[model samples]
Target: MHRRTFLQSAAAVSGLLPLAARPSFAGLYQAAAVATGDLDAVRGDGRPVTLPASAIKDLAASLRGPVLLASSPGYETARRVLNPSIDRRPALIVQPTGTADVRRAVSFASAHGLLLAVKCGGHSFSGMSTCDKGMQIDLSNMRGVRVDPKARRAYVEGGTLLGLVDHEAAAHGMVTPLGTVSHTGVGGLTTGGGFGRLARKFGLAVDNVVGVDVVTADGSVRRGDPTENPDLYWGVRGGGGNFGIVTNFEFQLHPFSGTVTGGEVVFPIDRARDLLRVYAEWSQKAPDEVYVDFVMSQPPGGKGGIALLHVCYCGDNADRDLAVLRTLGTPMANTIKVQRYVDFQKSGDYTDARTMGEYMKSGFTTGISEKLISGIIDGFEPHPARSTGVFTQHSGGAIGRPPVGTCAFPHRHAQHALMAAVSWKVGDDGAPHMAWAKKYWATIEPLTSGFYINEVNDESRAVLNANYRENFPRMVAVKKQYDPTNLFRLNANVQPA
Candidate 1:
């Protein structure tokens, strides 16, 4: 049977269907939970079975953390993840206080044929971390990060978020290649070869990944890194979560913890044409210590604005980084100042926790021509009267090239990772933003190197092929070794070997 069809049937039979069918599964799961004397089964809506005292004792002995059944008060809180879009009511949400808890949860889920979801920062835009009516291995409480000042490496738990990583590393005057959004999860991002402001100078988030200890699908613990389990190590570097549940990551750190000079500069809508043109030109030859990014959004009036850019320099001279920006040209607003790296990351902070009915697209650019520029501009003009602006970033530095087949992230030599985001507030103007961006992208067809894997869209099937490119086959091989059944199948997926 097709995997999805089999999965759906299994879920229905196991009494773990989506919320729409949650009622039906609740009974079957409850019975299993009772019979096994373990928290193995759960209804789609998360109701637990009434177990006898003997069963409770057995379940408690097997758990590393509190084994929360659906009726428990903590069940509601334990069941939640970061993204609002994920409304999954798992049969059980196991907040594993430690590694043992995680293992037990994994074991139970596997034995019972339950769907599983792994959540760290809960910021996944694609909702891959949510299991509608199965098991959840939530690593929220496993927060721990220890940095080695001498070795310049950090031991970070799977639950750590980018913002926390930045804050802790800054305390030691050190840093690592992370993600653009501070709220992004370290585990998912690292596994997928994440990029950040430091990418041009250092590399991708996964490039700094020295080692990882994961709990595989079958409940076996394995260490993944270059020296041991080399294939699995490379697979996780950018392979997404096809292997297993990662518990910790050891990363290489650099002297970027202290304050540096950086911030955003907003340009008038009228200057977007010229500004983007200049940005495209300057980025090609920009230095290692400097990074440039652009954000174009639909603002009030008929005009869309440009976030001129943000630059971060790890050098001792803040003036040199400032000069890089000045050398580019004068800006309407340069918030660039002597500030910590964390401060720079927060400059573009969007406080609205509210996820919107948005149509956001992400992709990489090896080259952007005048024709492409016009198309992007045309897409922005009539978006949500006040929606996200364009975001442009430099690429291709130390992080750009690894063995091409080393990981799933393929755009090794690509130049820029740009995003075309069109979102709106409730009852706000949103149609124009979606229409404009989609049409503009259509106009720029054939210019983009396949869509970057992270920016997957229904029409962007070709993009995934490009993102993995030469490494696609290797990824399949590694995937098969760890997850032959593709239990963790989701995201811009690579079929298991």
Candidate 2:
């Protein structure tokens, strides 16, 4: 059976069983307080805001979805985000079932000056999707995907997972460029510039976006496309979530066979420099249908660290295109074969879920240099307890075809997105792992350019401005027009000019 089908069946069975009731926040708050009653929350400026019991009750009644408070039954589970490192407690969580619910939640936040955070897949590396002592608009319950095969377009709900799109689109031999992880939220991934196995062949996920239904700071639902609301459309393509909540995304799909020749070729860590050098030269001249990434890491239960070339070829000349990679070094293992694209997309799901604490620093590189290859190899320090690696997400095919100011994402000329990532288990001191990641990134940072907004952490305002380059001014102008109050400032924020 397919993975998703099995999971759904398991979930249905689990739902038949009874669940335990946890303690509510009745004692902590007023003794007579109900789940959606009076609450004390924080404002956007760190001030206090009190919501009367009646107001809370009205807000809950106005929405079609459930409003969760600290005393709510599913509050614990609803407050959790994907990154285990982030531990935030929101005053309330509003699980919106549709655009109307989202608009109400946004308007409530705006009116009350509440610190607002939006959670789709809750996959923000910096935990921008959830906040403390604030209101969280959770979209987990709004996952719905509809594919128009005839039109070659997908209408995906904002909170939908990438795997659902892959599954639904594959049913009709269609696919959209999305992030590699199946569980990643389409809202965050596409809004912040998505990269994946098929990105080089098609383009960044933002490039495929045809239209969007967004709710801005004023609680207004607007359609953004080429002709209508053109500026808003351009901003939503690559401008992170700084403008508003994108309730729905319309993606242009490409005809696909549902299978691709792809897998990893692994070699010992000692050959990383040579393999990477070869990769730098070969990947530049590779066909648009090929996407290859270089990863250096120690696999679980392996004897030592290794260098891997993760290749995905969609064209007919798969063997011819991959021949140069095979001749580079004596690979320990080569698993390149034709496989279902959806299955390939889920290959890293288990590993990604196992990661409890992760710290990553990423930047874009126009071209890989010999010094960079040496620096990457020298900075790599493999620890038996933790997973640390330097990897590259291949770029520079159709991704660079768009002009710089065509959208808010300005890193169009980048050849690769490089990252230094470290992961540690739960209860482990992440300081050491994070330190190592930073040290490793320092060596290669100078040779790289800007960062991918989706993977960005705690970067300074000036650095972010510089990274956005010449497009920052235009982005600010759009921000001022759509969200003059900067209600959506939790992302790689573009402050209103």
Candidate 3:
């Protein structure tokens, strides 16, 4: 997965290699030899706490998985997250192997009043999955996915990557709408309103979720579905990780042909404005099977900014729709072709990996207006050492079919999700890049209605409440009922009432 391969494959496709293709974590959990000592930790409110060496040893011995301290063999790697910009060391890291391990870890954290963070794929942009001098429940060792062809369903472990689900379901000629990136943790993505190539057709990942096995703040493993704990189920769909730690998810899968016509149509930056105007109108009428993204990026070391229309068409009328897109403007490069859906899902893996230091600001838009197009073009300033861009993921269709209050995700009427993003080298000074992104967002933010919770970064509680709208109170009630103490307050937090 080289940079050239990514560009040729359309780097905007959700990025992730299959689980088998990822690096092995075999020796990362050899915790038996690590000596236990008194641990200094922090409570959720930044208060200090300590666990006696005897208690640490007993807790380690209780779990079937490994308990990693700072001195452990793989502690360094275990603490690292996808965003290199976020560097925090937890007092102890618990690598859970199953639901039992998760329950024990949560119970221990609760008993000790230790600030707890949960890490799946470690792709949280805000670094909510990791914390300093706290306890981190790392799910890296729990990647397991099972697909039932007869039932057209996927049972994904809480720590499973989206790529694993894609691989397993594709084998059964089925698909579930997960996030855009294949390596994203299913737990964080689905709980935050998952969106991907097939989202328009099949709905979000949360929408497909039929049931969940979760460990709440009380360390109780509870099952939630329409019939069992329906309120909890509703809260989990779009309420984020505020309610509980989802140990397992049962998702309804849809039949999908293994192959689809998809790829990128790249145009010079000059044609961006006109093309966006055309896309604003054309995308509204596009069928459910047509999923597209408008991406603008100035690749590091590239000549200038370029606009790309990333297309994934599963319908029979791709030829007609694509022809219309090809005529939008003279594209500098057109890589559109028939490709396996699984392969397309992996196309952006290299790009995602390359952009280790990432900053993003995103919001849901009702439609692409002339003002937004102008704001995006005007604010986009290319940096020679960074990859900077503005992009839009097509929404609507199945996403809006469900009523606003059907689940916790309230932004059902948005037609597209717009984001301004910039990425630099891991250790480089990101201040300039972040400043640019914020300035760029300042112009477009006013045009947005609400935001997709997954991309939330540094937004205030007032903004969160406004975005959640009428559902905020209900989410607060669920949070109070499950996490009254706000144990899981790291995410797009819903403070308990």
Candidate 4:
């Protein structure tokens, strides 16, 4: 898709699409090809407490696949995340090659009374995908994508990263909207509410889903869709990793094509209020064909601030199309280049991919009002010297409106979303950023009540409950039906029956 078309589709998703029109996922979901790991070779015998080697032994023996106990050296390597602060200890780590192994692992965890946590790209701010001590089900190895071009659909594994999906889907001239960072796990983000550069045009990642392969607490695999186990399917869309472990996800793809012009445009931080006002006004009436996320970031050495705006044009009119910016302000640097959709997904991680640092985060207001803008301006004047401040980007043509009941994801038609994040070196400085993050957020919350579920930290308990609101109740009911014993209690929990 050229820049113009991409913008048009995005505009439809975020603004023009009817909420109730979400396609019903009524098809049967299939698991991956069965490998040697499909069979359960042994029975489990262990408890969450008493560290018994027998339980570990049984878990290993029962799996036709490989299982790594925490004591094993390999466990350390697989458990590491990009955030150094997220240090978790697991009793056992299982890498299931296929669904059968996942089933076995779930059953073992339930019967043996072991805590269960599932990891995708492991980008969760609160570390929901991993726990301090538990049974870790790492799906990072399940790299598979099957695209049906004629059907305009794709079946993606739970562990698949956005980068991989963007690369694969873009190849087909079809795309599924995903998060900003390509390294983010599609499962973790989609299971919550996925908003990507394409969101303004396409809708939530959950909105695009056709069906999902879910393993209930009973360890029995079933496809959740409108015609089969419909209730579970409803809950998984925006309900989070609560109902059960998702093995595969089927998505309805948007017609996407070739290179488009998209990327960063930085302006002096002093122009934040002006840019913010422009965003707020434009966001309300913006077409689905445009997606532009706004960011307020403090660069290194704390000189001043930057209005880091990320823009994507789905239409072929990059030349005459992007003159919209002149309405905003004089850009210090606007280097809009035409690049492949896959390359666009890789923009953020290019400088920091596979990098580790200490990070603290919170969420708040959509567009900064005069009051909030003043507070932000004041706050940026003197950030903790060792740390950098960031206000996450939120805006795009297609990201604005969806009915509340369309799916479990409730954040539709909301004006804006913002994340307050601070990243610093591990031992060098963690306290100042944490303190600043807390102070800044405390003031930011009065202006806004909603926040992104996937970008939270330790204090997000009450905030997340409020953020998703009524979706939680329905999620609980669905969780009861699929996992009565709460076997899949780890990660962003969906309470069981």
Top candidate (TM-score): 3
Q: Clashes in candidate 4: how many?
A: 34
| Candidate 3, 197-302: lDDT as tens digits | 8899999888999999989999999999999999999999999999989999999999988888988888887777877887888888899889888877676665
* lDDT leader: 3
Q: Which lDDT tens digits does candidate 4 get at residues 233-333? A: 88888877777888999998888885767876778877877776676665556566667666766533555556656787778666665676766666888
Q: Which structure is stronger by lDDT: 1 or 2?
A: 2
Q: Mind sharing the TM-score for model 4?
A: 0.85
A best-first ranking of the candidates according to their TM-score comes to: 3, 2, 4, 1
C-alpha RMSD of candidate 3? 3.5
- Listing every candidate in turn, what is its Cα RMSD in Å to the true structure after a full C-alpha superposition? 9.0, 5.5, 3.5, 9.6
Give the C-alpha miss distance for residue 29 in model 2, angstroms.
18
Each prediction's TM-score versus the true structure: 0.82, 0.91, 0.93, 0.85
Candidate 1 minimal-lDDT segment of 10 residues: 1-10
How does model 1 fare in lDDT?
A: 0.65
Residue-pair clashes per candidate: 10, 0, 1, 34
Candidate 4 at residue 429, lDDT?
A: 59
Candidate 1: tens digits of C-alpha lDDT, residues 1-497: 01111112112112321321112222323333453443444432344433244544454566655555566445555565433334566665666667776777776666555666787866565566666666677777777889898899899988887888888888888999898666667887788778788887888888888899988767878998778998888878777777788898999999864766666666666677776787787777666767776655544343434446656666666675446456646677777677867866655444433334345566678867787788777655543243445666678767666767656667787788766655444365556756766775665556766555544545444555456788877888877888776666646666674
